[model samples]
Target: MTAASPPSASRPRYAVYVVLVLMVAYMLSFMDRVLISLMIDPIRTELGLGDTQVGLLVGFGFVLLYSIMGIPFGAIADSGNRRNLMVGGVLGWSAATAVSGFAGGFISLLAARAMVGIGEATLSPAAYSTIADRFEKRKLGFAVSLYNMGVSLGGGVAMLFGGVLVAWAMATAVPLPWGELTGWRLAFVAVGLLGVPLAAVMLLTVREAPRRQGGIKPPPLSALWALAMRHKAAFAAVVIGYSILVIAAYGAMLWAPVHFARAHGMSPAHLGLAFGVIIGLFGTVGLAIGGLLSDRSAKRGHPDAPVRIVLASAVLQFPLMMGAYLASDTTVALVLAAAGMATVSTIGGLQAGTLQILTPASMRGRMTAIYLLVANMAGMGLGPLVTGFVSEHLFDGPTSLGKALALVTAVSLTIGVALLLLARKAIIAAVLDNDRAEAEAG
Candidate 1:
């Protein structure tokens, strides 16, 4: 047999640059996604809407299309020029965001939000697949974790700076070529337009990874389906476990600002600053710890290191979430929320890294798409909606936000922990099987 080829000597600087771009892209996607959370009250008061409708706008509108489109986009990323795909995607979502500024009512705004979801869907599969190829196995966790930091950074910026922007827009009512748009509307347009230039930069600088399955076209959906079926238990565990985790995470994320406003009577700017620190700073630390722990565990020959770390996070998350929602004092609630954000921050990067490790490079995009489809639809799509439903229907008052949030977290996270633990054996088996296959191929 021929010897394996020597590794590429690509400069480490290039990889760092690439990760930074993707992280920013991820941050922008999230800023667009979560900005609505901060504007919930303004939109509701202006439109004569209720919690349920706001929840739909925040949850289902974007997620339905995002979840549905992710599969095909993932397939595209698997075979196409990922950089080009991202360029179009960024422009599309950004334009949609601007269009949201012009929305006359709930339906039009929802339409624009859905469009944003579709565009944002193109990002993760391609970014994840590219990062997996750029970095090697041992360092994969750290690199992916670093990339995932966008979740916190973007979220932080959205609340911290988004609050400032909204307040300024509200106070100044700044004139523009489009007329004096309202503060919330101005935000949608401004943030949306920000992506257009960034897309151009990515188009100019980012390059596609060398496809691991070069010369072999990406397999069709049926073939991908078969591969997934072959590892049914592990996929089930991953999809279900993460889905459950996100239900709690997204529910809280989308509503936490609203909760603070109602419970503590905080200003939008204050709420933004509070959550910005909670999620942004605490989350950054969590991702770092999780990534270091996972990478070290893998280097030490632990096959299930990623999942194990996620499980540990889940364990800590249960209490943090419970305490945050249940705490009567505003300061106590924020403190608990910060601790909780740190733990959940680990979920995205570690889980993404684990999925990349288990899947062949050829199938990473599609697998990621499938993973996002299930995870987003369940976690992101329904999480906020259900929380709102409970708030509007069960509790029947704005003050019930805390109870609604707690219910979702307790039920969902308990189940998530159980599912992840069960997936451990399957994850290990897949790692061993993949290693054996690669050794034989070499």
Candidate 2:
């Protein structure tokens, strides 16, 4: 059930092509996912929604269907055509986003967002599994980091694009082929259309990578359960620890622009340009740093490099992240926020690469499914929702958002650090033991 190393050799040129495709795919999904953040105010105004409703639309609604559907999709990725799955996901989510443009009320918008979740649910598991098949383990951290840059790229682009639209819409409705629409609605429709060509590119250009199972039978629920039981500490560290951390990370991310807008009296266009550059430049740099550090440390006899990097990043991030929320000066907050985001962004790809090291090839997709279920559901789902609830209901309404953000972030980061520490010794032991066993077998 252990992972088998392929014959060691230089990586092929096509591997680069594959990573590019997956990275763009990752970017496309994020653009669709985050375009709403810039338009939250307009969406609320048009839909007659409150903060809680916004929380449901952006946070829980997407993660609910995404987490539920990911399990079966994960299994299919293990045994089916992952490239096709990616194509279907792109098409489905793209169409759903277009539909979101036309939604008359909260219920309809929520439904459309749910389908977006379902489509996106197919991506990470399938993409990661395919990457594992194509790249050698040594280079994998870098490859994954490159792919994960989509978060920054996609998010940055969305903010920038939505900001332009927002400024324009404030002046006049965007002229569509049929008629006209508000900036927020038009944002949804515009992002949705982008996926059509991407889906076609995926189908025509990218070929499926072979599975790395070494003749292992198709993974079943029993196998997945057994895998979880076998690596409880590591899984707990990654799943629970990271999820807790994401409460801080993703919540801060979702609300950051609003903080700038409400507290600092900034425009959407300004927030977009600032954050887009920060995310595009700094976030990408951080991902590269994490990957290089991980690979180099592993080469220097630290098999637990990925987790180690994440743990260190967590400690360094808390102060910077909290400072972003608490700082009085807008410029100071943005500077601190950029630093915070770099550290926050470092963990995603490296952690996924680390888990691949831990899991058997046969179970990578399902294991990822489980990881995403807990991580996305608990992290992305509750982080923003709880932040909003505390801000709106528990604290002073709306004005207390920064304070609410700091409290949530501070608590979650602390717990996350503790969990990662718990995971460390277990991970080191597992890696050394596996290496020894593999050596003997060879």
Question: Cα deviation of 274 in candidate 2 (Å)?
Answer: 0.9
For candidate 1, lDDT tens digit of each residue in 375-419? 898887898889988988887454699889989889999998898
Summarize candidate 2's per-residue lDDT along 1-442 as a digit string, tens digits.
2345542224467777888888999998988666687888888987898878888888998889999899999999888899999999999989998889988899999999999999999999999988888877778888889899888888878777768866765566767697887667766777889999999999998888865555567757897677667767877787788778778767756787776777787788898898887777788888999999888888887888898899899898999988988888989999998998899889766868877877766778888888888888877799889887887887773347787888889999999899889778887776665556445543
- Model 2 Cα shift for residue 4 (angstroms): 4.4
How does candidate 2 fare on TM-score? Answer: 0.94
What lDDT, from 0 to 1, does candidate 2 have?
0.82
Q: Which ten residues in a row have the lowest lDDT in candidate 2?
A: 1-10
Worst 10 residues of 1 by lDDT: 1-10
Task: Itemize residue pairs with steric clashes in candidate 2.
Answer: none
Choose the strongest candidate by lDDT.
1
lDDT over C-alpha atoms for residue 124 of model 2: 93
TM-score: which candidate is best? 1
* Cα RMSD (angstroms) for every candidate in the order listed: 1.9, 2.4
Residue-pair clashes per prediction, in order, are 0, 0
